[model samples]
Target: MLYIGLYLVAAGVGGIKGSLPTHGAEQFDESTPQGRIKRSTFFNYFVVCLSAGGLIATTFVVWIEDNKGWKWGFLISTMAMLLSIPVFLLGSGFYRNKIPNGSPFTTISKVLLAAIINSCSGKTTSNAVVNMATSPPSVSTQKSSDTKSKKGQEKTSENESLETQTQSFKFLNRAVNNTPVYTALKCTTKQVEEVKVVLKLFPIFASTIILNCCLAQLSTFSVQQAASMDTNLGSLKIPAASLPVFPIVIIMVVAPIYDHLIIPFAREITKRETGISHLQRIGTGLVLSVLAMAAAALVEVKRKNVAIKHDLVDSTKPLPITFFWIAIQYALLGSADLFTLAGMLEFFFTEAPSSMRSLATSLSWASLAIGYYLSSVIVSIVNEATSRGHHKGWLSGGNLNRYRLERFYWLLCVLGGVNFLNYLFWACRYKYRSTGSKK
Candidate 1:
């Protein structure tokens, strides 16, 4: 987990650092029609390919894990990362351009907005469900047949159905081929190129905050929770690390529902031409995070009280009769993920400049670094101070055995609240700039 976290930090920072304009002038605009079209194509290809690669790579890792130890798996992953460097650096030269001197906050704003959009897309599922529930029912009764020959009428209906199918396929192809990033990539100007790079990197960099917070919890507090509780699934006793599996399983089930049933409904009812924006989805994730922490806090409170009753000894194992805390953590985290992760993918791919889409994905992973640092700082201060005297407060000595983790989790709830509020303030103020727009 630590290695993965470090890797995320490295890649995310590199992406952010690399996206800066290397030259100082704007070179292209929507008026440059041919140039914009090519650039857009490049962007589309970059996003689709990069996303596919990551998906493939992750699947391979999972596959190898069952047959081989982590050492071999890491070795292969490291090799893949090393192999990709040359290509990224080669692409970087094409992407580099200069930025005008202005507020550093512009860069910050860009990152924040990118993050917000990604989050909005992430909430596609919830939005879909809401829309589905409210939509008017469809009337499917067939009209009485006209007096023409039944065979002729049947042939006409079949032709109509075939034409509809053909149109649907064509529409899907157009959607894939006509993205802005793809259009931008074929362009020659530096300005258009720079814009493309920004779109590519923004989603990844922005996502790091939430991702780090989430992924880190899987190995740490989550593990501790399992260890302190009775983890029996039927007759099988599970390991602490296995706790993450529950959330992963939930994700698998929920993902299909969101993609097939929710997103399309949301796009239709919200009157949002592109469905909910990424930022809105991320905001929903932040809200779910608050609930997840609250659940953890409740569990901690229960554990703490139990410890006090059992005399707080390391050897005196106070078994929690129920493993409902585990369920809460899994459910809350799972729901949060449905919004944030998917949105981040779409957000980074759409916003990133044409040449550096992979870097954008890396940036999303990097948010874990920031969240980890924050979690670490909070834990250190609380634990160190508590250990100084006889009292552990929330984290000291054996208090956690008493389920004091609840307090720490509550603190996270507070942090999530603040994060969400700040996010909302920024999102409302942001003005989106479409790539190649005249103004």
Candidate 2:
């Protein structure tokens, strides 16, 4: 227990130090490859570590035995925090002495983070305008010849005017694509490159809702698994209330380690200027989530075997299954924090027109709301269908016991698979953009 506390403290300090760059403390641009990669790497590592740790802590809390296990988790967390004091000091050597007062990403992180887990309707609007402006002209030009004679000369002038109009519209579209609506327009290659980025980011944004839906199931359904599993800590009977500790401890500790170490190391190795884009990280995270669900489903199968051996037909009684299954779920789900939420944070801030940062952050939350609705709807449909049969429905609470839980797991698996495929399709088609003048 003491070792765990120490380890968590050390990791947490490291993570917080690394995350300072994004704490509204300093400003960085995504226009340059170096800048974007650097920001993306740090952000991704931070989120992944945080999520993984939180899950571990959650598992511990749920599985821990005793009346005061929750209090012990807190004690360890506090000590780990105290240990982080030196980490903060060490970080000062790498980060600037003072935090940056303002930047584009500061207020917008919330929106992107929210969008990662919620059904967002507004984020598409900004991209839509940019898309419209960049799309090719619908009208075709007619061929005309200029005459050296008087009549021919007049025709020549008309043709020149029409040519100029077409060019003007083309330039206008390019200009809109390159720069933010709020910024002064200049035609530059760098600006154009930024607009082109918008194209790359489209798929990631499209997947936002699906990711949200999957994540929403984590707390509600996954914890139920822990509750049903038995602990083998001798006479000490553990309750589910203390399971959240493991994930929380993991998050609080791992957050700093990845922030300071893994991110910087990866950036150095990859030679990516901006590190990795938020979209890439988020995509990776979505994949990890799918793996986590798969792990959970496997655990369910294991639990069934244990039940058979014990001759226990009661669904609610704790089975003699190992706790590692819960731990695996926590670890994998926690890792997602690095990619999904972090990517959303950076994406929303950078993609949004500067004025709507608040709105952008809020858009991410909409996915969570939508996910809840979707989960409920799916569960209701399944329950209705399976009522006459022995199958379990969506969101069914423990009545059918293992069978019902198994059914829910299968449902999530199917949903997550379909969602991931759709996300990939859109991700491939989307673009990334920056606010600047084109050369």
Candidate 3:
């Protein structure tokens, strides 16, 4: 029953996270400059609003679980979940609905299969030559080709203006043939274009998983680290679980300042609609994640030293160090999240084809989810690699004081640094589809 309920909750959370943000963003018009600006603001506040709920959970809900009981915590969660239904329904009338054509996976699969089948025939058709061309064609050829390939040309107002986006993935352009090798393998220009957008965004999506891997530590090992520290605040004890409040508060405070003050100032200097480019914002977050890991390592070193000084290294008792020490990493990761998450949401949504915006935006959370899973895998791999011939693994020790946590943090820091370099390689080369973000 417990497992079932957990799975149910996960399903519900996934649905809400994927759908809600896309729906809110659809409310804003992205067709005009003002509308696009307003849409960007919506993504910012979306993070702020999520942080608000987190603020309550980390403080109020966490306190209840610490002092009162776990049952009360569950009860409060149930009530909140029940209450949110009506609140969401109340805004339905004013909401703009984006009706999906079908599952995006189907389109992706069709395009891939078409590209494969059409290319396998080994026919270098005129359409393939046109799409795979490295340089612009002569004026005579352009006019003649346009007349011949009238069907492939997008005449719709939305797709007509951006015909050049499909040029990057030339192989897939074969999928758009009028007379495909197989009838089922035929695709449209919009389909090939959308698939190319998804493929191009892949590297950026994978790069942020390492940052999420760092973030996963906050809930697991970071809390355990706090559990070994002094959690007292003016005679009022605080729970280690509630330590997340530090980051939550930071997000709530910093998000608004970035949107209101920081953005306007940036717009003045850059004269760009999006004050900071999405890739720049994501890169900033990646850099901070590297710093966060380094800070965590340093803090771990400081913590271990204090434990040894007090002769508490072999014991489980709380050391003289304050729980606020753990807040250093939390604060950094929080700020990283503020930049990366908002940037990713906007980058993925604005840059994606209109049909796939919801799916693209959902990739942000998918990266986070994969990161959480990856954290555990990393720990397991570390344990296996270090446990050699009767030597206990760095993180295998039951006592937090006895663990070589600093070494583990150092490993993450190094990985994050490498990931940032990888991100720079791709981000520098990435072409922005949006006019507001054109570099």
lDDT (Cα, tens digit) per residue for candidate 2, span 107-145 = 333323333322222221122233222334444422222
lDDT of 3 by residue, 1-439 (tens): 9999999999999999998888888787665678888988988999999999998887788879878999999999999999999998998888787676888888999988888887898754334423333346699967876775332432233364334335677888777777878877677676777888888898999999999999999998999999999999989998787887787888888898999999999999998888889999999999999999999999999999999899999887899999898999999999999999999999998788878888999999999999999999999999999999988899996788878899999999999999999999999999887655773
What is the Cα-based TM-score of model 1?
A: 0.56
lDDT of each: 0.53, 0.54, 0.86
lDDT of model 2, residue 120: 28
Candidate 2 TM-score, true structure as reference: 0.57
User: Which one wins by lDDT: 2 or 3?
Assistant: 3
Residue-wise C-alpha lDDT for candidate 1, range 269-304, written one tens digit per residue: 875433456667767777888888888778767766
Model 2, which residues run further than 4 Å from truth? 1-203, 232-237, 389-397, 400-402, 435-439
RMSD of 2: 13.8
Q: Which stretches of candidate 1 lie over 4 Å from their true place?
A: 1-211, 308-318, 355-359, 385-388, 434-439
lDDT of 2: 0.54
